[model samples]
Target: MGNIIQLSKSSPTSEWIDMSNQGTDCFLELLIMAANDLEKTNHQEKLISFLKDQKDINDIAPGTAGFKLDEMPWCDETLIDDASFLICVTKEAQSESVLSKLPYKVNTEIVFPWLKQFAVLIELMITASER
Candidate 1:
């Protein structure tokens, strides 16, 4: 069976989002999209660097090096807070995917109200970058 990553705003809450099915590919796509936006704004260096780091992390063998969200740098504070939320969620999802390989299920819970705000933040960043 494929990995499953479930996220909730907090414990005791009835609402939980399942991001496992989408897998890390979805997160990578969004990051690439964000990186593309950064590139259009003359942030080529940051884009290249971030992509390289992502690739390096992905290439590492499992149980050798763990994924870290804070390692990814932010060029602008405009979306830093929101982007950080997305990054953390993505990291947790990726970690859970690996942990799911064992005979156990991984369910992650995040305390932030990121689900509803994530879409808005992405839109805002995209719109702002277009200017």
Candidate 2:
């Protein structure tokens, strides 16, 4: 198994405060980099393929499934562009249903795919999270 690195050390509270500030700065920088890349390559087919592969890994299909989030989780790390959109599968068919509320311009609907074997739906969830 891989080892995990703890971000905090058992140190003085002042040191921890400094570390927290540094960590937040680092996170913001990473988020900015990710946003730049997302915008630069938003229309690239490769990125779409990458997203599709991730969706498959998460067992996300084109139609409704058990994994659709009732409340859409916003992805704070990603910045959406014109091509940036959300993909989800839902069987619910009410006006107030989760799927129906998604913005029409950026959301796509399809049947959910069955997973071969895995409890991890992080791929799709992360994609949704990114949106």
Candidate 3:
């Protein structure tokens, strides 16, 4: 995961002054950094670049264990079941055909773990926002 998602903001380039990440809002912090990176790169940067500003991931992220994105709007049955989101993402990452559609190179080793961690946060927000 050290290729892109592992590039720590603190240890990397000292030339570009990184904005403070000490804010209490974890979600807001991500949005702010995304906006900052977008502006600096003329809005042409890959998602991986934004990932570099995050803390290095040294271990595997936990799989789906709570609220599911594929099951939103509980009254209606319109989404995939629990864990299917993770399965689809992993499938796409592993597919050579899907890889061609991406703007950046796909390193399955780096991506799968990132997806797991990302999926959890998404589920958390969905659960919170829906409440």
Model 1 residue 93 distance off true place after TM-score fit, in angstroms: 17
lDDT of 3 by residue, 38-78 (tens): 23321223222333333222112221112222232222232
User: lDDT per residue, candidate 1, 5-116, as tens digits?
Assistant: 2222231223322233233334433344444333233343453356445445444532222222223344564444445444444334344344344343423332123233
User: For every model in order, what is the number of clashing pairs?
Assistant: 0, 9, 0
Compared with the true structure, model 2 gives a TM-score of 0.19
What stretches of model 3 exceed 4 Å from their correct place?
1-94, 101-105
Q: Count residue pairs with overlapping backbones in model 2.
A: 9
Q: Lowest summed lDDT over 10 consecutive residues: which window, candidate 3?
A: 58-67
lDDT of each candidate versus the true structure: 0.37, 0.27, 0.33
| Candidate 3 C-alpha error for residue 91, in Å | 5.8
TM-score of each: 0.30, 0.19, 0.28
Q: Give the TM-score of candidate 1.
A: 0.30
Clashes of 3: 0
- Give residue 115's lDDT in candidate 2 (0 to 100): 14
- Clash pairs, candidate 3, are none
* lDDT agreement of model 3 with the native: 0.33
